[model samples]
Target: MSQRQVVQVFEQYQKSRTQFVQTVAELATRPMNIEILQNAGVMSLLRPLLLDIVPTIQQTAALALGRLANYNDDLAEAVVKGDILPQLVYSLAEQNRFYKKAAAFVLRAVAKHSPELAQSVVDCGALDALVICLEEFDPGVKEAAAWALGYIARHNAELAQAVVDAGAVPLLVLCIQEPELSLKRIAASALSDICKHSPELAQTVVDAGAIAHLAQMILNPDAKLKRQVFSALSQIAKHSVDLAEMVVEAEIFPAVLTCLKDTDEYVQKNVATLIREIAKHTPELSQLIVNAGGVAAVVDYIGNTKGNVRLPGIMMLGYVAAHSENLAMAVVISKGVVQLAITLSEEPEDHIQAAAAWALGQIGRHTPEHAKAVAVANVLPRLLEAYLRAGATEDLQTKSKKALKNILQKCVHLPALEPLLHDAPPNILKHVVGQFSKVLPHDSKARKLFVTSGGLKKIQEIKAEPGSALIEYINTINNCYPEEIVRYYSPGYSDSLLDRVEQYIPA
Candidate 1:
């Protein structure tokens, strides 16, 4: 019971506690050790240490829990089930800066997995504490807090609104303006997650002067920072016309165009996505993109990349071309069709092909010149191939077919329409004939080629109902040539002639 004996005993307990936490922290670093740690009932072991009277012990415990929970949702759920979150949220308010960082890290690690786990963090009143941490003098603490808020907001709109209601937007905006590049990157990303859910939430971000501050870093040399900045701007611009206009007004086009060729693929993809969001709003907005030479830049990105990275670029072309004939021509003039055709042929994902097909259709639907631009790229046959493939997705089929119909109808160019004659389905065959009905009547030379190429023969064999447009189109095409020429190409004319000689001796 002496003072010396009591002091020795207290020191022994503190050293053992520190060693246990240090061991747990180290073990949590390797993915292989998580199972062992979990089976040792580590969650329970660590629960009380989270509030250990010593700050390092408490902080280390939170760090260990975060690392273990970060391994997978199962462990994250274990963290949730172990009721570790409330304590972490509680510590976020009471702890020192480093402890606050570790606490926010635990909350973020849990929230990053699923909406349900994020809800648990929110249910523990973590947002307000984390928002308070954003005001801390330490950059590390603020960075961790911003990152946690970003992850929580990323799950859904309601959770995002919860982060917003905690008064985090202005603080996050300030974080982006901070000198610490890491804080800026995460704050920018957190802003993206918050605004990506809905227009009202996006307005909150925009109202806080996020655009001008964010725009200031649009061309920041750090590729990671640029990616987040691009994403945040895209999220805001995606919501409404006025908001997109706000992004455009920030003079973001040149910097955005530069990032389209960023060394980082994510930066390239994200910036392309930003342009697509802007371009989808209206012809005026699309024109703004085209004026900045966005069409050519996006087309270049599509050409040089593969897989999902090219999707936003492909879609940007579609959105741009969809706006007006002038914009479509801008895409066409930039050789957008050529890159799009390559994606259609080379990209394996059906959705990417579908997007390419949809963009091509948008490009070719505007005028004969536009259609011819697509036609000369040898894209029509490929489009038909996509449409008719047995394995084609319904979306791919619909987009390709619509592209074919759009192009073929506007395609006054006879050569492109000729090959489709042999294989186009009856529905599409009608557009082919309709084009010939309009053009062959005006070009005697085309009528000759139609007969010699068996285009006439193919048409004669088509059995169209008398009153449908196909039949009417067939009639118009027939009237373009001599009646004998049409009869000579008729399906059974030769057989009828031979039957006249002998009924083939069969009844």
Candidate 2:
């Protein structure tokens, strides 16, 4: 039928009979017929049908509006502009389950267009109505209401806060605990959206008992659900230190560490990311990760996986190393320093290289022994090279320079001394020489080897002028081991002594 024919049929049926409105309602449900109905300016006509005494016309008209709004944003905005939201909100409380479900479907489509339209729906008090629907007997109505709320809450912080303020969090948590896996997934996802907006909002979800539910769900062997659960936990953990501690208090490390070895790459990456977030700046949490074998798991992934899967693991190792001296030493004990250095030196991707450099820098910030471990891995030359390479981003350069400075200032092992003397920038070399004077004891083998390895000659060349720190350090080393230095450079220097010194040097 043409637009005029549809309009004429509606006009003839106006206030005349229920059968006429029902006929038009049935026609509105068809996709091909919506254009004709719209051309007839039927949105105004459909408004009264939303309140029709007959349940069939009410259900069909709401379903038709939903279908029509699904076609494009203009129709959805038209539905909102016609004041359909309050009517839909009212229909959600109807005794008839069909009317409630159909109204929720329409509202979901209408509010899915944009943040402005979503706020329009929320402003009409649709959030309270949707929260009420969660307690309904019909699962379909509950699921649809949860979906609509999820769509709105996912758009922006204000709408999400609106949803939470309407007391939707506990109800959504209830939905997640239900036996139906599909509804549980939707509810979990909605809670994730709600918590992702901010720490205050995320704490609200945690206070409502989401962490326990999500932690339990993460343990399931199903890879798909585990992915969703890990992602939700990660979002929650990202916004606050308290939430991260809650994740640890829930004892989620074992399950999370298991996910690091998951066959699915996305699952592995997200789980690694969650671990990284939890380990940030919390020494106790970092130790928990280390105790649970998380450090080894990440190191193995960086060694065994390629492309995107390895990047998050590298980053996790970095976060774990940054927390404390003991944790940094743990990373060195696990050979993480060697793995990170390899990535910095050999990985083609600049992001991975930058991340590796960052992890090394963290490791280098601890005691002199920790710095010596990194230096023995032969990472300083690669860091210097990465710092000098053309086209490196400011972030890459900053990380490289920071790592180089940390190693030079802390490491006093003799084998790590030559590279600083020969390869480090002038400013860094000055710091290295000063650090050596402080860290090396007067009678130490490392001090003896420093003079034997041409360290004094290199320092004299790099010193700016007489009585500088470099020059002063040279005087201290010479005063401490004058005889050994002269014997080492003399014609009859023992090969065994030189061989012992060479053993400490990296190949």
Candidate 3:
């Protein structure tokens, strides 16, 4: 039928008119027919049906409007501009469960369009209605409501807080424990969105007992739900030490570590991220992760050909190393040091290079033994190369420089100091001098090595200036040198004249 005939029939008010509108609404849902209805201005015809006396017609019209707005931003904005948000919010309060469910579906579609449209949904008091729908007996309505809340909260913190203020936390927690797998997944997703806003809000979700539920869900072996569950746990763990400790205490690491081997790249990536967040600033926790086989898992991911998997994995290794000497040693034991060195040397991605450099620095900072291990991994050259390479951002240069300094400070190999002295830039020369001052202390063997390595000559060249920091460094080294002494030795009774000889040795 033509658009005019359809409207005319609805205007005439026959017994079957509701069915006609419902059929038209159904047709509008199909991609092939949606454009025809939209071009026909069918939204204008269906707007009144949203308030139709018959609940089924209202339900069908809302569904059609929702589907039209599903993938089309323009139509969604149109729906919002038409002031349909308030009507949808009203429908959520309807006694008819089907109408409420359809209304929620429409609201979710509209809110998902953009942040601005989502704000409109919130402004129209959709949050209150959605929270009420969460308590609905109909599983479909509850699922749609949870989804709508998740979609709205995903865009902005304010809206997320609004959802939480409307008491969505406990409801979401309950939904997660529901028998229906789909509801559980959606609720987990919603909880993830809500917690992502801030630490306080994340703690709220944890307080609502989301951690236990999410932990259980993560073990389901359902890749899709597991992804969402890990995402939620990761967000929660990010905000506070207590939350992270809680997550660890819940014994979530085993499952989280297992996910690193998941075939799905996304799952693997997110799990790596979770491990990184949890391991940060917690030395014991870092070691726990190491003991749980996370060290090898992270190393394996860093070696993956896929950048997505490798980047986060590399970053996680850095976090683990940053916490403690033992964990740093764990990284080296896993042979992660070599992988990071290779990444620093050969990875085209500057971010990966920077992260690897940072990880190496963290490892080298612990002790001379750890620093030598990083040096032995051959990262020193790559670090210097990374610093000298053109077009490297200042941040990358700083990371490379710091990593090189860490290795050099603890690395007693005097040969490594020679090239740096001759070729380093002025600033780097100063740093090298400063590092050498610490390494070359008041000892005869060290002084001899410093002299043989042309360290004295390098200092003399820089000390030529009237005022130089090198003067202090030179004085420091000179003060450590053995004083010259004249020794009179009587070789035999026949030697009348004492042979005077001067020899420099440790006093």
Candidate 4:
């Protein structure tokens, strides 16, 4: 063959290989084509191309593999079983920046599916290669490697510790401080994924001076970067009291409170969640949030938002109030209960309603004053209504019932207790009756209203079993009213003599 003819044939071969990989990359973008591509024995065809003499063909093949593995776990396992991972990991260290990015992406795609799949990537020494990629001069390589490391570490603690063992933490910490916005975002997210698995892991990130760097990024103008920074802080704060205190010591509170009103809803939610995590550990932490007006910011966020965005705000109130009666009062002073009552009554999702119920319970469970605060918002009836509805979730019913019992045991407000007598079921009715038993014996006007409003008649119809607390409360309330009136309202009395004017006799 002539030399010119041989060169023409080689060029044709490279062109076809390039077209095949590029076509697969385009087809991979549509999820519906994954099975079609796999059925065409794409993995068998693509495996040999990972080591193509031309770098574009190699990188594009890796890109196609990453997309296939990213679509689902079965395809990810296909990449693993086809022996594609080992070849990619081997090429990852020797490749150019684009190939390194593509190979690291494939590793991340496989590892993100499950711990076993991730362990397979680890077994192929992908972490060592990816860690080396993080040290590359190219920013894109660093970002891709950080993202892959985060995915590998995200599955569980063992895998996370494995990434730590590969010496990725200090590199990732340096990546967060880099001038590139995308790198900072990805690196912060990677740090959060690393630290979220355990207290010890979080301490590792903290010891690397991550909190100070992350806290400084909170002031960055980029919305996405701010989201990751707040997320890292929240994860670190959630692990333990000492860790939570470390986050607070960074002086991120009032700055985070300002973010509660930020235009970004996620920023608002993460800020509330971070505050809640800090407040959840101890009374002193709760007081720190209260002192910073964190409760009020959360209250405003809850008021303006809907669905899941407001959930963190609602829970922050619960955590703050759960710490002590004084913090509970702080929530009440901020109009937190009213917002929670609104959410419980007006929100569409059952889980959100359940969260609001749980929050209101926290606010009202502390003391009589707190109970009255919740009662004044008219949350009691809404809670009872939600609890009794047939479609309410078991979680909602359980939380609502517990809230009722908690507040009712502390409530001194007679007017709020009256409406519940008309509709409460036996488990909840006992609480209503018990609250009345406490108040009616002391207040004559309330006792008179209890009868005139047919509340006493409502109690009479309950016919609680012998020696039950409902019956005991009934007896206590019965003694507070006139015996004749009580006997008239008692079961079977009206049936006995209402029609017999000439001869009236009790049953």
lDDT, model 4, position 133: 88
List candidate 4 stretches off by more than 4 Å.
491-500, 503-507
Cα-based lDDT for every prediction: 0.91, 0.81, 0.80, 0.91
Off by over 4 Å in 1: 1-6, 496-507
Tens-digit lDDT track of model 3 for 1-507: 999999987777844757767687678657898778878887787788898887777878888888888858888888988888888887788648888888898889988978998888899999999999899887888999999999999997888888999999999999988888788889999999988879988988988998988887666867878878888988998887888899888888666777787887778877887888788847877888888898998888777745546777787788888887888889999999988877777777787788889888988888877887887776676788789889998878999998887776676555556667776766667666766676678456776777776776566556324457755665665566553311111123234342322343446
TM agreement with the true structure for every prediction:
0.95, 0.74, 0.80, 0.95
Model 3 stretches with alpha carbons more than 4 Å out: 1-45, 52-57, 68-74, 95-98, 415-423, 433-467, 470-507
Give candidates' CA RMSD values in order: 2.7, 8.8, 8.3, 2.5
State model 3's lDDT.
0.80
Residue-level lDDT for 436 in candidate 4: 91
- The total number of steric clashes, by the backbone 3 Å criterion, in model 2 comes to 0
Ten contiguous residues minimizing lDDT sum, candidate 2: 484-493
How far residue 1's Cα lies from its native spot in candidate 2, in Å, is: 18
Stretches off by above 4 angstroms in model 2 are 1-115, 238-242, 306-312, 346-349, 435-507
| Candidate 1 structure, TM-score to reference | 0.95
